[model samples]
Target: MSERVLVPRNRGFLFLDSHPAGCRQLVADMWQACPAPAGVLEGDGPVALVIGSSAGYGLAATLAGLKRAGIRGIAMSFEKAPTVRRTATAGWYRTAATAEIADTAGRDLVFLNGDAFSDSMKEQVADLIEQRFDGRLDYLIYSVAAPRRTDPATGAAYASVLKPIGQASCTKTLVFDDEGVAEVREVETGPAEGDDVEQTVAVMGGADWERWIDHLAGRGLLADGFATAALSYIGSSLTEAIYRQGTIGAAKAHLEATARNLNERLGKMVGGRAVTSVNGAAVTQSSTAIPGIALYTGLLRGVLGDGLVPPIRQLAALWDQLTGAAPLVLDDEGRIRLDTWELTEDVQSAVAERWETATTATIADLADLDWFHNEVQRLYGFSVPGVDYSAAVATDIPWPDHAP
Candidate 1:
């Protein structure tokens, strides 16, 4: 009889597949990257709630605030894919690593898996906040991105669409070739329905943030001098037709407006303020998937690597503003503006010139293509230092503090 070989179950898809050692290593890395300042909140400090804290800039914000402020308790909501394959989102790995590090450091971290758009989830979250911290929260962060949302009142679903403002348009994009020059044209799909835009606003906008604040305040679970912030982005006009003028852009505008409303309402409660940080554009998982952006990002990455300002640098600056190291500047729209620095007149002019007169010969002069490709890879947790690619990673690897 032939001997049978058994294959280990693939569980990385369900969880982050994080090991205690890896988690510790990650914490050590992050600590070294951004060390805590003296006299900051320390030793089992204030509680922070991060909604949509699974991936992208949201995860980055969570890490930044946690490290800077020495926050000890964290509540996070993340949507995970249900599958048997090893497809853990980056946020899952980050949360697992954070929980492990916090446990060893004598901190408190709670992670909840739920749909943030649902009412039941909000109630449960409110209950958790009241029960855990004696009705007091110090900080709140809202960052959510979704393709579609169902209307609570109408029982109808809305799907967001990306397109130009007036009519159909085509744009050039990057393609893989030996010469690093290829043209991929894209057409604007069309405008989404008004209801669709409204639904998208409801799901991705500040409604959840407001709910969190209202519930916490009504329940007397908010600490003194609390602060809340949400992230916003305004891409360049070249891509704005498909981004800022589209359904998603409408939702963002609503989110920004909601932040002001919350600031007015929540400010009176605990001497608090609600602010929105205009963040930089990067090749995040969400941003890369948007049409025409990958090409622009590829170009931008190349240009920014040569002593030019990049979005990550902008994020660092945003953190400085949040920590009171610098002042935040606002535009006429009552929204924080950072994209102006990123898509400056000179930068956009240069990219436009390149776009018009670029060919195989012009591609080399555009910028370092290699840097652009690597940044995209880094977004997926690849090409990061300290990770061993040679060894086979286990899917059901145990986190340091995972109960099960």
Candidate 2:
């Protein structure tokens, strides 16, 4: 009983491996079509840690900070498990269906998988937040996307590329599968020579997000008004010469200068804040392994149709700019753009007029590549929606009663 197909790899998409009740019915139909986070908070809430929490936009900001700000999550991830010839990584059944839906809503999670740029996974997430989160954290969300990195004190490995910094360019790409848009080419890339933008800024910069906020702000486990963020992307200007001036935009401009030196050392030691945010352009899995970013996310989802804002509505507009519902803008270098409505100006002037008529016979009539192939088959939990993909299920599920 193993028929969960959709592989098309060369670093773009992969699935054929995942079941556990169809990845817990796509994480219970994405938190039953997630919503509740416009505003809500009533004391003793925040905890979150989330470093690359299993899947895109770090699993939608770790399920919008534990189902919309009732915070208390821990997450981390490297992924892949199930055996006897595979079936797991749909982020290990989306972290065992986010610990069986945060233990049936009595909310609390831990789920660390490993190698979160190791330092023994930051002292195993600061000893599981000092044995079950009382040692304090408030929020730290880094959202890593590895390709290679290994310098936990000079083990020196580093590898991340995706060329285009100063020469060969071109554009228009699509050619996907898993049943959708199998055409549209042009392609070129090639650049990022020599120390390839310093090994893709030592494998996607922000130096392991300032070494996990300097080891959770030196283990006194950071909390006093604490807040930290990382994710970044610049988009538009037609993937500015292969993504914001290439080499992963010089590793997102050294992760926006390591989020202004982690917001001036977590605001002079503990009034805390270290933002960066940015994000937009959806279909993740590290933006479909980037090369003209899946034809600019299928012409920016055909110019933001349904005002395109996935990644759980951009992590609920970044948890409504970290709970205030406003006043947390920042841009001219102070980062946090949150893709300000995916860079409006009429969504980059209707995606630069469908990027000069996208080709391969007008990309299925101008891009949306079937909503980028059903959002890469709903990021590999397989075209979810009340599941039941011919039921055969079970492939060793369990693991996540605060897994570690």
Candidate 3:
């Protein structure tokens, strides 16, 4: 018998096949769904500078800006390139696929792969903007998720940790193996230790985001009437201790605070506005790493099935709000809320009820664990339908060439 080929696996995460066709299909569906305002100019559209624009909300926002606003974009990300032993990260293929579509559609897209937190990378992107797309950008999307960061000036490394604030808690967490077996494991998380919270804030917080905007503004790269949005999340009370009220939560609070600060500064300086777009939770590379998220997502699916909004859908809704299709609504804190429906009372009530009674034995019945599993794999570009898994794929793919 011929050897059976399976999706490549690393560290229990199955990296999806980066077949150009499958990537194209995913982009096409999202692009078609994004509603562009009528009478948008073809060649004179807005320009967007998207930081961390490879996966999840970043990728979705990029597609929406392109398809709906007819905007040109420059995407910056830090993703792994394919090695001799394995395929590239899903972001690599997703970016390549988006570039291919942009070419066929005669849209402008430029992707730069590097450390978004670094001063040099920011400088490079600024230079690219000034040289290629004039000296101004209309939109800046920040959606980076990373565990550690190195300060460019100080060379200090900070790592983010996931822990509750007050005390240790024992919870039921989900673990997936290479063969895709889902197992519930009991996890005990302790409180953040000395400097843990501050370190996490330093790494995952708004400082870097503020720095990026400042850099662009200093260089005259922000256009008049420009807008910038950062992605944040506030899930159900089930994850309050570990997520919404934990170290990460502190970082998010800082992010929102930064948004308000930037909103004031940008409005005064360049007629720009900054807002935090509170997002809904879905299976993504970052969420699965949370201790109890798999269980919660499964329960969430059982409640919000057919109504769960993925990143792509969420971005399209955001576009509508930006273009006035929907009212520009903000939470009491002045943050844009795309998670309105996800956090509705009815949805949370249902999820809470299921969450209260859910056990490992009862999870299979109360939650759509299978659906969550597939979605997790899909985040990495695996399990996508119509993509031939057995076909040989190119490990090395180049970015689309752009002329100055």
Scored by TM-score, the top model is 3
Higher-scoring candidate on lDDT, 1 or 3: 3
Which tens-of-lDDT digit does each residue in 253-328 have in candidate 1? 8888888897787778788878787776776667866777766766665566664444434544555555565676
Candidate 1: clashing pairs of residues: 135-221, 136-221
Name the lDDT of candidate 3. 0.79
Question: Stretches of candidate 1 above 4 Å error?
Answer: 1-32, 35-43, 81-83, 104-106, 151-156, 175-188, 306-320, 323-329, 338-340, 358-364, 398-404
lDDT of candidate model 1 versus the reference: 0.61
lDDT of 2 by residue, 123-188 (tens): 988878878778888788887878899988989998988888879888877766434546777888
Worst 10 residues of 2 by lDDT: 2-11
Question: Which has the better lDDT: candidate 2, or candidate 3?
Answer: 3
- Count the clashes in each prediction: 2, 0, 0
What TM-score would every model get versus the actual structure? 0.81, 0.35, 0.93
Error of 3 at 230 (Å): 0.6
For model 3, the run of ten residues with the poorest summed lDDT:
1-10
